[model samples]
Target: MKQDQDNCDFIIQAGHDIYYTHKNVLSAGCDYFEAMLKYDTKESREGKVVFKDVDSECVKNCIDFIYSGEIEIPNEKMNDLLYAAIMMQLEDVKQAVSDILKRSITVENYFSTRKVADIYGLDAVSTRCRVFFSKNLMKISMQPGFGNIEKTDILNFVKSEKSGLYEEAKLTLSLRWVENNRKNEEHLHKCLEVIKFDKMSPAFLEHLLESNLIISNDFGLYKLFNGHLLKASKRLGKAKGEIDNRDFIILFDADTDCIRSLDPIAEKVEKFHDEKFKHLRDFGTISLDSYIYVPCENKSVHRLDCRSKNSKWEKMKDMICDHGEFPRSVSWSGLIFVIGGSCHKATNDVETFTYSLNQWSQLQNKPTAICDASLVSLDDSIYCIGGIGQDGVEVSSFCRFIPFSAEWVDLEPMRYPVSDMGVVAVDQKIFVLGGCSGGIEVNYVSCYDVISAQWTSLSSMIACRSFVSAHHMGNWIYAVAYGKVSNVIEKYDFSKDKWIIVKPEVDQCFTIYESTFVKL
Candidate 1:
């Protein structure tokens, strides 16, 4: 085919060069050439085709593929060849180019290839590149070529839900982009708009404001950040429970006097203050705002600010009543509520601690005297699930308490009477996980729809766990193990109706017994 250039009947012009090719061979492989040659098009009449925007080498590659069924493409020429194939409507050539591009995607060249795939609308190649990009965002962002990525790609990535980066990480990436490019206000605004400032920590927001990056360059961004900071301050407590803040579960290990923070996503564990809480057992733990409050049996409370790198347990005011012996606690409306448990015996005593007030107030006692009950707050009320009643027998009784009116209302009973069950509320549904039923552990998982006032059974967990701390973060319910199964953590997937165990990297078994799991 290369030697038959002298007898060629067609001429192809591309970017300062012309190629000789047979018209019959051109029409045989490419639909674009066949249609043009079969019709009264100017190209057919003139016996010539022109692709002014395409490079000569790309045109040569396409022509070579038309004659030989294949063409060798360099990593640097894949984009241009793909473009030429798209223009020539060569489906096979496009597929081949896309495959090469997919295989060529690397951390260093991701931005460049992603840009080409996105521009040419190559879904297969784009999807693969995006997956690679999401998985290696940190590494890709640090590359020297990161600053050269298109603004559109950056904005799309920043707005993507599957970017696999935390809000702060996204913010850092955006700032780095702006710093590298020295972008104008219009571009800077788009970058700032996608970042979830409301989700970032107050300390990070403060640091961002002090940094010369934003403060020195853009006034509009500074004002916008200030507004976000103000709103964040107003809703700081609630923000601490947001999805970004739920990256780690902080557990107060009473036996070892250590605070263990476990990152379920990262599967890593780190311990702090190994000897801090010596003999700190039988305490009700609740996290509000960014602080973890441990209410001791002696009515004294110790608060730890999780924001600090070296945060220590600071003493707070004593509780008004004795909230001792496996008392159930929940944080609602920025207040810590410790419900019924035994001080001397099973008592209906209830107390709520206001962090802002630093004072504990006794509330009306619960109607039923119970201990080891699962307490979860939903909407404007608190639900106290099954537990052992004062008669020393486990009951399936369910009740709701309205804090505003201070009234307790009895509700539908659970299918099985259970105690020490992991219970948590997400939206209008409450999930009651494995617990003890008649002195035996049950892997039963039940969900109660508050709106319908009905209980429905879901898939059972792989392992039975009692005294599990079930936490609702993102879309899954994490049941942190207790008793002999302390090393296991089961995650409930709502969509799949299944439970999967999560293993964290820890040097020792999680001694989660009598330990509190607070999503931080």
Candidate 2:
């Protein structure tokens, strides 16, 4: 083969039969290939060589780069390409890769990149990774992948002089790490040694000692923790003035299937992916005993544990019988009440599900058949709002069911005939949002006082829409419609007695929706 050889050459195979060539163009640019071709080696003489270890995709890209002086390294594959370039001693590709990696360091992947760079002797890239980690350890430690990182790698950073962290954050992060990785209990002490307990506040150290993490078979480590706690607890009082963790625990039917939560401070929406129940078309949801109970289609009820670390939506026993479509529900004294919501002739059916017994029973029916109405429970009674009857007449009457007396107590009805109304309970008062009346959307907002047995008309919502979901947080009421520009999420202020648009509303979605407020 000559300098300008026009002959088939080396084959680089990977993952079965995938192969690429190291031709004249590659030999000129790559020192390894150049050496093989120049020294009268077997590859030079035979005009055919095979690299069994070369990655097929990577070698193909290298060949393209050697010939065209251009190649792309995707973010996910940059490390692989860097390794290939260094092995082949391709100066240009190696330099290009190192520069991009050094400049593109992120908290999420800096530790991983640092590990790889250290092995490859990429000092500049390694330095950037170390710098990023040291500068942002507090924030980086809170990242999603931090708890899953290997203990050895984290210890390596902790041992570094450049790791500019005080012992306070280290204590918190270590506890969080163990909380997230309970399976890694064997590595607890090894990880805890990195946190400087001597520098932590006495109150914080006492809190740390109170944590059940010290309950280990390693008696020596346990004694050492208690030794620190004995001295710390004697010197300090109960911890105070820490960051306030009070938060709203929101539970709402996002769609017909899944439930969602809204964090006012975090301003984030988290969906209960496992809680989705297909064909769910009713607005029946209640929070009781730290679980969210929802009624779905096919007469099936599902529950999601609000207090569980690993919560899942589980199907409960079907109702004793169908309360019919759109049956309203409320939870009180460990019992769930499902009532009202039907088509054709209105039916006066009421079903109650007992949480402790895991059984369903019939409750006293409403004074009259109520369909498409709303139910809200306050104390020992369940209040049923307006609905339409089989005679094609809108019901202006409202009633409350007293569980203790096992009797129906009629309450003053809304000023206007209402159906498909949005009802939410706040304190001793119940507020109803906009709904449809006589097949037409109405924007009438009404509030009923339970103690006074009175109905008070408040400010109306921004739009007239039926099938609305309302959530109560503190003194605010959030109303979201399932029909029409559902994008507008409105909030009702009890103090101001007015409705305020929450700006950028929730995403548009249909299906019977429900909402509950959780204050933490």
Candidate 3:
């Protein structure tokens, strides 16, 4: 069949007799013809077959590849070759044509080629085009063909974890894309899923509240955003107990650098420092009454009693054993647990102090050296979220320590790695917030489910937030909004699954050494 092409016994015809080829030869290389010719049908018995609606030239090129494993794909006939190859299931020919087309992609043709790639299931080509679309996102999106991108493709691109567009730019362009195809406006919500709700400018969030596009469609997001924008400007609404006590909130008032007391019920902040303690930093606690602090200088323990008559910062006894580190501390069940910080070098040593005995004792060591990890105490356990791993790399690892067993068990990690994050526990589940480094960042929000042993991502923050400190009051969670564009109180309602920005009536902006929830 290969050597005697001119005297071939079988004849295959297609497209108005525009082309003809050998029967067995075409069947060997083409999946469609192989099964068709296996039977004693008229075409098989008579050694002839025909195909309509296929370009004669594309058919000939495919036949050439069958005989010699070589074919030239012209740019003009590229789509024709693609369609014919798919119809005949000529994988090798299809692959060769796809490779050539993929290499020839440009900003001018990315959208069109991507359409073809997707329709024909050319995944490799499709992947390449999507990446190209993401990298040159803004420039290519303004092109005419950008309007032709399918709604699913648009959703996938906006939420792409690899997308490098700035939050503001991404939202702006994406919203415009939505407006262009307003008939399919429901896809807008899906597009909104990947956007950083916290990263948007306060002014923009205000603007969104008034948009028919949002208010009429995104019911939950719209309602919560309206509440926040109103509160930021000192507008009080009838929504009571929605942002009330979780019992507590952590605050770092710009007017006072010391950690301040947050009054959730009255929506007020109170003085946190007395004469002897004008400054406090790097502290932790799980108990509502008093927090345990391991000072760095003398390495002494200090206590602030909310119920004490004097209510002054009192220095407790020095650590029983000098670990040579002032690690972050958290108190639970009248006991304080210390973990992570430099003890000459990064260490994972664990120690506990008893409130009754007032003595410190060593506990089981942690799995790895971690400093600057986000710590949250709940459910008789301490959750140690994202931190530096053994080799000093930012990690997405999550681990929990059971106080009774003095053992650390690893949990599923957050979707993104973060440092200087805020963790709040409400109802045995923990929510973790944002971190930024260098020039790139993620306004990521995710939660760990104790029951499911799974990590679920929540909506992103309003804007880029870093070094945020947060606490919970009932079902509502609040975090410090600290970025160049945002410095306010950001509230999140679990039921609403939306973020609200509240501006404190502070005289001026303030920074803090540390912030944590304390009952006063």
Pick out the ten consecutive residues of candidate 2 with the lowest summed lDDT. 237-246
The 0-to-1 C-alpha lDDT of every candidate, in the order given, reads: 0.74, 0.65, 0.63
TM-score of each: 0.53, 0.49, 0.47
- Give the winner by lDDT: 1
lDDT of 1: 0.74
Counting clashing residue pairs in each candidate, in order, gives 0, 1, 12
Worst 10 residues of 3 by lDDT: 236-245
* lDDT (tens digit, per residue) of candidate 3 on 40-137: 78878877767688887887778777888888788899999989888878888888888887798886677779878878889999889877876665
**Reference-based lDDT, residue 501, model 1:** 77
lDDT of 1 at 85: 85
In model 1, the worst 10-residue window by lDDT is 238-247
lDDT of 2 at 214: 35
